[model samples]
Target: MKKIGKTLKSACVLGLSGALLVCSVGCSSSSESSGGEKTGKKQLVFWDKSEYVTAYNDMMKEKVDEFAEKYDVDVDYVIVNSGDLEQKLAAAIESGNQPDIIMGDNTSVAEYIASDQLAEVSDVLADIDLKEEAKPYAVFNDTEYLVPLSLTAPGMFARQDVWEEHGLEAPKTWEELKEQAKIINDPDNGFYALGLPLGESGGGDAETFIRTIILDYGGEVVNAEGEVTVNSPEVLEAFKFIASLYEEGLVPPDATTWDDSGNNSAYTAGTVGVVFNSGSLMGTLKDEYPEIWDNTAIFDYPAAEEGGQSYTLGGANVFGIFKTGDNTETAKEFISYFFSDTDFYNEMVEAIGGMWQPVINGYDDTEFWQDPDNAVWLTAASNLTLTTAPAPTTDTAAQGFSNHLCTKALQNIVVNGMDPQEALDGLEADLNELYQ
Candidate 1:
């Protein structure tokens, strides 16, 4: 298993002076004015992974500037590459400095919750509305600390022309998807039905897709005892389905080692006819290759097996205030501001090219989604509940990285003739041991 905290260990090791620490937190204030008045604007420092960094450039900076002007508080955005965020946060937490607010993986939120770093929403966020899609992340010990932003997962996409020419409609069931995939797997036509990347990309996609299928087979990642349920007949069914997909030649040969961007490349190169993809991903295809973007069509994941939920695993970005500094109040205010700030939210959507519903209730219906631009993504997140975790057992299973592991397990099953049941069963055992 890949160790998570080894690199972060050095950065987070305590005993270092505050001046020597690298910060992952933004703005917060826990101190009452001691003997003097506070001066200057309250600067809230924030950290997010790299994709959001590009988004901040996409008018997010301007939106913060606008929020600063409107609320009279300076919002400082700290951009960190997504891969390095955990290490940075670990380091910061070690030295008594953490971001005022952090937005990263949905699964990762459990780690923050386990630490003393987070502030319970309590009455502070009581007024903020939440979507059905986001509330599952907050149900820890019957309390919540996160305000969800983006709800994302892969969906099916196709070249409209190919579907029209072949007279194939969107597949709603696994059987149909396989049948359609077989028809489109013709190498002579320069088209493949799916983008095969068995590395991390394939791994994650495979896990979620299979998990949904497992659910179809009456399987779940955990059992009634709150332990793993991966080694069951249901999971075996899920494995059997994936193995069938590979053995039947529905997936491309290079899927086992395809790089990060390989799937999208296949779509852009017009080498694929159908795929499981997302609307947020479309922006790249559009900007880099508008023609491919035009040919692209986004849909939800097809049923990999009969009786499956039209589902994808639950995933979202959660923001939290760290347990550092005297800036706790400032941190809470920023969370409230970030969640409720109308202008900031809009700019966030505009910059990131992804939509994050505002935290306040009913805010999702706030004309923003209805805009022509948001139509596609809004749909992607709409029916996502079918794939979400049952309450009381959400992030605890993965400790914030289950999706990552599941994805990897999927990759193992996709190529190499690995058994899905054995792969998931092993993954379940390891994951259970981590938190056991």
Candidate 2:
């Protein structure tokens, strides 16, 4: 929600390396050793990309320290930008100087696993089904290599005050969203009924926002075969609908240059009624801005047409042990300890402020999720997904495609104004290239 400052304005594939790649990783060499011997306790280096990892890292270290005292092991936690993990891992891949554990995603995680750089952790959390949302990135070559950290799906949110003032509820259908957008877009009153930050690099934010709308309209960004299928007629209609929103003046003109915050800004300022992103925002909103916080509400992606479902995408941060690291067994042991213990998992979540939903807890009793604070996320999680959960389909293809397609493909469409069909066509062609 920080004002769009240093982030690039586009979400294109060419820019994926820039946007999602590590901008800079906060690393510590204290746990490092002089050669093959480690000095301090039986410590292991664990790194992942998450600015929101403060509490989790601390708790992780706490658990590791406890384990270290009991089992004689050391766990030093390091924070890296999500984008940086790939860059650093790519550099360290050939050097065999990798950390004992790497935390990333299926897309990013695949590179390590494919090269035999990661341990097959099938035994670590064998009891964990990992749910579908996690499978896409967690499993590779039918072998599980990662531990899932959270339940992830993008969510839609709005200012509760704006909804009440406009006599609206979360739109159940796409038409209703559009209709609601019309009423909120009374420019004379300094409001936009809806938001689409087009300026986030050639509509990068627009592309993501629009992709959900496309799903609502019956489009699938990823198919069962793990290939991109966004060029279909159903998706074309979705894209055309987006273009129409732009032409109809539903989106702010300045949206194209904005980063993720444009929508956040407008919503918090009461200038816009609705926006879609991670529900994690609710926690931050609660912590920082209290006055307008109560006006917030969560929404499912509205259905396209009337009966269609809304499906937004989300990714999870994963934990993996490197094949080259010194303490391979210990690394896996810590991860096992992390997941098998429910209290430890909750501590991590509480520390991270629900920025992540525990993946292993997918079958978490429906009871706690109904708490007023979690009500919106529970609904948003259920509403924004087309599936019970999202686990990736084509393992190799998913990761390679992610590094090759996912963010970049969407970026191309957003920045290039590449015709939705043509853009996706190009993405398909690229997927074949990676597959080869």
Candidate 3:
């Protein structure tokens, strides 16, 4: 509850400042305006995240250069750190200094739509082969806005060698998962069975994990009709289950304070037997620890009950056009061209590596996606399901995520020793107020 209090205070401060105070820090913008202005070329501003991934940045530069050459546009390409994107975007929106085209986490797109800062791209989507299931975060009020670039399904991963040493198979049911975790729990040697990031400081991973369990149990924070349902019986079961993981000594004590990278570091350090994370963990294991990489295995999140459906929290990154920008047509054309060019898109996907999986309909047939090493994760991505959030409902879900609602509720139980029902009741109250 203390952590939640701090989060609410921080959010309030940010809101008062219009969430733009951090926009100037580490801000860098580059322009290819040179002689293009003299030639009457249109000026297009493009912003993307991931400033540290050299390969991704290089690929983006190459693509932007090609776009400029083909379309006669002066592109101002800005690379913002992903963590800083929300604030930077908020500042840009507040000041009316919007980029023509921007790529961001799918959640941010929902927030932008809530604020009416995005330009509609229904005409662009009509020309493309956008899949129905893939349209959840990209559409609002029956009009398309986001061009989903790629997605990731964060599923469960385990150290195969450890499981083999313990003579255990990957758990298919939540009960079996817990039983196996209890068997593997050995904190005396600095090891734990589960790498659950329950801390609100862990960023969205905790919320995603909690929501995945809730969805698996046939519960949701908000139903299709947009009513707050956090206190449903299924959600209570999910909450008590999460608390049991900690109370039974399966999760490490430090999980209460670990940030977004906590579980990743814990698993990499050989301190955890199983971790629920994105496919990127496979990439890390492959690059930094080949021994573990060879023995690593992935599986879908264990089912909530023996016969229940399995679900993994999923999301995507999207390309969007700003309503305030004057280059809407140019932005739409570039998005269309990027998606339609199969070769270029595949090359970009390769460059992106585990950061995102292909979102297009036919990419499952691509050689890159068919590799044996990617089997587990590819299956996970293909089966990913998302919570429905339409129009006004979408805005509430985005705010819930941004506010770390579920994570806070889990912390209230695990850290503050509050009753699971009470924590859930508080969560329901908060959400009802938010969704209202």
Candidate 4:
């Protein structure tokens, strides 16, 4: 694993946009005195991202309760939606009331680390044995701020019955996908070939899709030294190719306006032949729409060209300790306890339908990962390209991803009909501004 450290050119300044609305789940406030004083017991505030699987949240609540009893601490566990976490966290930081621990995606961690609000937890990571692929994403500037909890990646979900009816097989490359999409697209029958989102809303589904394409086409947002390199010919080609998908009507027309759940909703509704998302969609299908789940087949992301290298964007879902509050040690202890029971952790992952891949080395060899229906997720986790690849995982790149710059550029071309070069130029300027 490579350890990278760099002085970020700029600090990310988060604007306080709205009031923080936190939803508490299985919370206990009895330990606090009327005046908000701790009643001779340590209090730990934890914010967990709401999972798509309700059982995962429920299991975590049970674990938090157990930890509180085991460690003699009062815990206030809040479940925050992934889309609202950044804003709520920003509010908490600005008000000097941040939680002791937060669980979120890598982009949020990088943004917070850049703002100097996260505490280095390298000591906490030392006790856990992590997989080789999970190690690189945990370190920044030779310091660790996030403890990885699980892995997630976007996989191509195709309608097997639809493909079979057309005598087609799952596509293995971008050209094949487009060709198959053209043949199977039946807009008259209310089925589009693909459900690629280009919208700027939600937590960067559009950005993830576009960035994977940019890298697969040999483009880089930045070089290894963290220099801006997005305005090159390769990037321009990538932009044109993506815009061509919308232009040729291969993707849903409203994909430009979709939020994070747009593709999931479309896939569930059987309006699109294929969609790219994590296993959360698969879990949803199995539980709510088993008929559709029965026909859905997951595949690795298609390569940019025939016989070319393929890439998918993903990273570990991590736990970040905040520098705020006096409960840093308490938070670390709870994290250790959370992963202490290897059996329970493995069971929880299986219960969640393997939507959350294991970050520990030996956890992946279990029967759950070997199941054919669940193996694609394991394959994706094994070969993840962190959101900020090519460039070191720096605050600047993280902020760019959080801002959805790539998606915005694609929207400018596909939605507004701006020239691809012009959009790429604007994207370069915006990214350079962030890096500067």
Cα deviation of 106 in candidate 4 (Å)? Answer: 1.7
lDDT of 4 by residue, 143-212 (tens): 8888988888778899999999999987888878888999999888889999998888767778888889
lDDT of 2 by residue, 306-403 (tens): 56655665556678888778888888887777666776776566556555665654434545554666655544444333221222443455454344
At residue 308, candidate 2 shows an lDDT of 60
| Candidate lDDT (C-alpha), each | 0.62, 0.63, 0.78, 0.84
List ranges where model 2 is wrong by over 4 Å.
1-43, 127-137, 186-190, 197-210, 226-228, 257-262, 361-368, 379-392, 395-424
Task: Please tell me which model should have the higher TM-score, number 1 or number 4.
Answer: 4
Candidate 1 TM-score versus the reference: 0.78
| Candidate 2 lDDT for residue 291 | 72
lDDT of 3 by residue, 243-353 (tens): 999988999998988777899999888899888887677677777877877777876578877777887667777888998877788889888877778777767766666
Ranking by lDDT: 4, 3, 2, 1
TM-score of each predicted structure versus truth? 0.78, 0.77, 0.88, 0.90
Worst 10 residues of 3 by lDDT: 24-33
Clash counts per candidate, in order, are: 29, 28, 0, 2
lDDT of residue 165 for candidate 4: 92
Clashing pairs in 4: 4-141, 5-141
Off by over 4 Å in 4: 1-38
Q: Which ten residues in a row have the lowest lDDT in candidate 2?
A: 382-391
Each prediction's RMSD over C-alphas, in Å, is 10.2, 13.1, 11.6, 12.9
Best by TM-score: 4
lDDT of candidate model 3 versus the reference: 0.78
